[model samples]
Target: MFRAKNLWIIHLLGWVLFMSLPLTIVSREPDANFPMLVLKSGWFWSFFLVYAVLFYGNLLVLTPKLYLKQHYAAYAAVFVGLLILIYVSQPFEKLIFRKFRQEQGREARPEMPRGGFRNGPPPGLPPGEEPRPMPERGRAVDFVSLTLFIVAWAVAMAIRISREWRQSERRAILSEAEKAHAELSFFKAQINPHFLFNTLNNIYALAVSSSAHTAPSILKLSQMMRYITEEATEHYVPLEDELACLENYVELQKLRLNAKTKLDFNVQGQPDGVKIAPLILMTFVENAFKYGVSNHRESVIRIAVEVTGSHIQFFCQNRIIERREDVERTGVGILNTQKRLDLLYSGSYDLDIRNAEEVFTVNLKLSGR
Candidate 1:
């Protein structure tokens, strides 16, 4: 409920009421004794000077540093110590000035009528004497006020801590979100370079052999380019479009492969109006070609997609070579893809992988929504 500007204004007003007002009010009153009057006025000024430094220095200036922790004990110590110093210094100041006055020729003291709030006398003191007792500063009431003020300050500190905690939590969540987005973009970027390189290799085959399928290969590449530009960036695209792209990719792969390697693909559910990532399945298919199936005799690859109204499942199984030295590999694109899946689907997707029986398999289930 408090702002820095408003709190500062309130502090300034409080200073006027407590310090300036009291000194100004007492100064207008006349005292009964010449020496007593001189002594009292001088004492009030001395107390005010000490009180000013302590109050302003601690509350306004030092509060920023002390705000680190709720150090009520330190605040209390400063307040009580400053007040005690003010109380003791007042009487001694009077004695020193009185001695100075007699040493000079300014000892012609004149008495005046009593007036001020302490016209009778300062409280907690005997009748006119050399050592007068300091008056009550509303002792019991002040004790209660100081207690309440301490509690209020602690409450303010608690509120500040809570606000900072919430802000930090929000920042952490946002940073995680940004990191996931970057990973997704990196994965998407990987898809392009790999696709382009494979297509160029296919084109090289056509140039080397003078095959008639070169024109269709060019057409398929164009379609894939269009998909990447328009639909790939979207979170989801029509399932039919995804399948069509997959079919194009398989045909493109066929251009470079021999008749020994064959691909089996199946679909069980409606691809009419459903949606999915444009290239999520393509990576698995390409991986199957790259690592799963070696360029050898009797190679087989299978891809199946089952799409329901509320969920979708995809499975890929391909044969791997037994004698390959590097059996396991994690490419940049795959790492980026893993991070993307974590952020995009989180708990809504399940992925299982197995390389048993010399056959690599991947099964993934993702929420449709």
Candidate 2:
């Protein structure tokens, strides 16, 4: 509202300056008689009143009604007609001034030098051509009017076009933001159900055996579920909070792994003030545990996270168990993670996966906004 008010104030001041030009500088003369000067000034003010009406009428009314509605030909025609009316009215305006001077002459002297104010068109003009010479005062007024008409029309069009462009850009930004929010919500919904199904299977195995680690495992699972349900719904969570959730998940998975199976997880640097998308790192870690561990043979799985002021890097590596089923299931989580990365971070992140020599390694890097 304040911006709108400021615009109106500027417009009013500009028109006020245009109206005051004739009284101040355009009509002022040092040597002219007092009555003649008044007569000359009247002619300028009369022309100015009509010119101002036509200029503002086009800007505020005709431009919006016709030009904005795509009626370009009609808009041009209307303005041309207005210009023609202004040009034709000039002679009648000069006739009014001539008559006033003649009346003053009857009361004052027998003959008063009229100077350059001509009763008719200049001599030696070709057919259908405009008069070459005019009264000094009338010529100055004509020049000012023509220049002002062109300038005012150009300025009004420029301001209107700029305002429309800004409004269109704002609408596009709002639409894109809404679309991203909806897509992120849908992706997160997929992640939670898939993860919970796998975690529940692990807990079922522990309950069937009546293992000592079953109670602790359930407690850890409860904490991780709370994190997923509460914190994961948000767009960003503190890096420290996300790391803590990762720790809980790894601890829960340890119950299913034998002593011979190595599951090492480490953090390298401080994660005090950093923020990240919640649960973004879990897919790779889950994939590592699912296919990288075996009860019969010794298996090694390693996960590491490094943090700096500007970026965070994550690494997960696991020896692939020689099983077709395990290999196929691992690809599902990794593919979903790639989709999420594209949707959320796009150009601000990097992910590399190596699946060769019976070993799988996943590396991810995320830069801060």
Candidate 3:
């Protein structure tokens, strides 16, 4: 399909509309020599031709090459020279028209009156007598030409500068998108390795102990890996899919937990039609299992997910049984998750992490897609 290259197509159409004004003049003055008025009128077509050339040339060439490129002195000098030429050329063009008329033995037409053309005689002219012709008005023509020149210059500059600004903004958006993609890729690389190392260690411990849960743990791990590989890499996934992956991870982690560990995982609402950033809530859940479980004490890890319309809330509260030094070691995952949230959701989500006394909690709220 054909598409417009840019806004220049619209700009060209506007100029064509303006150029058709000569035809309007021809229609209003049917008895006038329309071709001679348009083609031979020194201040009309000459002014339009010069204005058109200056408009496009200045915007398309001089602006990008000189003005936009910071060749301020050269750009100003060239424009000043062009203006001087235009000013001088106006009078010379009028003189050429007069000479042409004289050579053809045609009397110079009277200038339009100050208030513009009137079909009847002036107030002072007697009835049935023709009014004396007005003399050529150089100042009026010059003023009109100058006004047109200024308007064309202003409009061209405005359009060109606006286009350049939009282009710059578009480029900036593309650059930011690329940068965010690279950063997200780097984050995924960090997360996958760290998570795999921990999961593999748990599987190894289970296999070495000749535990009956080893095969089930491996099956759950396979499902978790599939989720991570296929769905987590995507920008968004169905909320149900993410919740299922979380369930698999929680089940796999349960295989290695001590008997005293109390874990409650609950989903409070339907996830139908809801979508969210994949694995966004998993890091908090993982941290709860890592630092909340204890062999000697009653340890509790609570995870809850609530969905209402397109709103989602995730809550994780864990009894912190590890020492302060060990707890600090778990910051990597949470920090990475926070950065991802900031990049992806920015102002659209809220994440609060609190640690008071022996309890650590994560509360996250989001407007899901």
**For this target, which candidate reaches the highest lDDT against the unseen true structure?**
3
Candidate 3 to native Cα RMSD, angstroms: 7.5
lDDT of 3 by residue, 12-126 (tens): 7878776664445334435467546555655555546767898888878887888888999998898778766667666334543344345446655556565534666556766
lDDT of each: 0.66, 0.75, 0.78
Which model is ahead, 1 or 3, in terms of lDDT? Answer: 3
Please give the clash total of every predicted structure, in order. 0, 0, 0
Reference-based lDDT, residue 193, model 1: 75
Which residue ranges in model 1 land beyond 4 Å of their true spot?
1-138, 234-236, 272-274, 292-295, 322-335
lDDT for residue 4 in candidate 3, whole number 0-100:
51
RMSD of each: 11.2, 7.8, 7.5
- Candidate order by TM-score, decreasing, is 3, 2, 1
lDDT of 1 by residue, 1-369 (tens): 666567778656665565443334334435345444543555445644644555555544445345445666785676567555445444323433344345435665443333433356446757664343445444222332233234434444454556567778989999987876677777888787777787778777896888999888889888888888888888778888888888888888877777778888888888776777667788778778776555665788898889888588999999876655433433555555666667777898988878898798989899765
lDDT, model 3, position 300: 88
1 or 2: which has the higher TM-score?
2
Off by over 4 Å in 2: 1-5, 16-28, 31-65, 89-144, 322-348
List the candidates' TM-scores in order.
0.61, 0.72, 0.80
